[model samples]
Target: MNDAVHSIAAKSAAPLPKSAGVTGRTNDPARTMAEILKVATHEFADKGLAGARIDEIAAATRTSKRMIYYYFGSKEGLYIAVLEESYRRVRSIESELNLENLPPEEALRTLVGFTFDHHNGNQDYVRLVMSENMLRGQYIAQSKSIQALNVPAIRSIRDLYDRGVVEGVFRPGVDPIDIHANISALTFFNVSNQYTFSQIFKHQMQDPQVLAQRRANVIDVLVRYLRA
Candidate 1:
């Protein structure tokens, strides 16, 4: 297998964490960590790893720079943690999709639509990813855990494709990774380039009606691609 496949296979071997949804811990330190991650996520997404300051994040939260360093070790460490937590939260929300009960086509539609909605609503996630890509994924490379966190997302697509094939509703030999890339590309561009796109087209991309139309379009595209 190639590197991507091998990485996904290895990551898939491990089960997701039980508390992948949220921290699930209500204690002080847990709360503090959660708080730090929250502020840090926005800070990093807004200013990036190099541009974002630890003191800024600390001042924004009810925490100190000392506590920030104490919790995350360093600015880079905090940035990595934010990256991991951001992906974890998105994947966690995806895990709650409960796609098993839906028909194959409907499951694919739901997945695509959910992704569109997520990317549209969570601009921070998009910005963080855009910034990371801008830096050629330097911080992402430092976090091996990110690969594991993302594996479930690909596995879900693979499982859905397998089921769809078995049900004779989907074309055979469609690679799950390809499907993911397609879906991500479609949805990600809607958010990552919305500002520039809006300016170029002079369109109100954020309007609710426009979003609804785009959401439907995304679902239709993915469903068509997956359908047999």
Candidate 2:
């Protein structure tokens, strides 16, 4: 009960480092928004907007319902934000690829492979997009941010297409939008219809072997279509 015991007690009672609370909420707005979006992304993707509950999302996040509303204005606003973040994440990763460094054919093939892998890995993103489309893009249409996010995606394709055409490796008059559509369609179908397709064909669509073969086939189809 003397100085030594008092020192030991004080030391034991002292707070830990800020990083010790790594998972705890902090004043960083970005982290808070990210935490909310991470939880909301799953909720919306699983249940869609109409079925997702604000209270449930708030419960899943470190933040509260009021905080969520404060950051996103409304449930619809939060839904749009989730969609925006989901798209942003995949597109951001795509932007990081050194596409310009690779040859045109390699770049396009790399892109197709990457897109196929990204869609499969991020099934939540695929579901979110499907839910948005099912609503005829009702919530997605509300966000001007998503369009801005997608512009660079199309620009990347256009640049790749232009380079390929100039190199005489790609056919002339290829549309970037069509290129995106083909790649997206091939990749998206794998995730979007995975359940139904698997059931219909009794095939294990989620198998790693199946995915690898499909990935190669998708790249081959795009490469063949683009080749001059």
Q: What TM-score does each of the candidates earn?
A: 0.86, 0.87
Off by over 4 Å in 2: 1-25
lDDT of each: 0.81, 0.83
Instruction: Estimate candidate 2's alpha-carbon lDDT, on a 0 to 1 scale.
Output: 0.83
The number of clashing residue pairs in model 1 is 0
Which pairs, if any, clash in model 2?
none
Alpha-carbon deviation at 177 in model 2, angstroms? 0.4
Please give the lDDT score for candidate 1.
Answer: 0.81
Worst 10 residues of 1 by lDDT: 1-10
- Across residues 93-141, which tens digit of lDDT does each residue of candidate 1 receive? 9999988778888889989989998988889899999888998988788
**Over the stretch 1-228, how does candidate 2's per-residue lDDT look in tens digits?**
123322322333344234323355656656666788899999999998889999898877756776666567678877877887888898899999989888999999999999999999999999999998889987776676689899999999999999999999999987899999999999999999999999999998899999899999999999999999
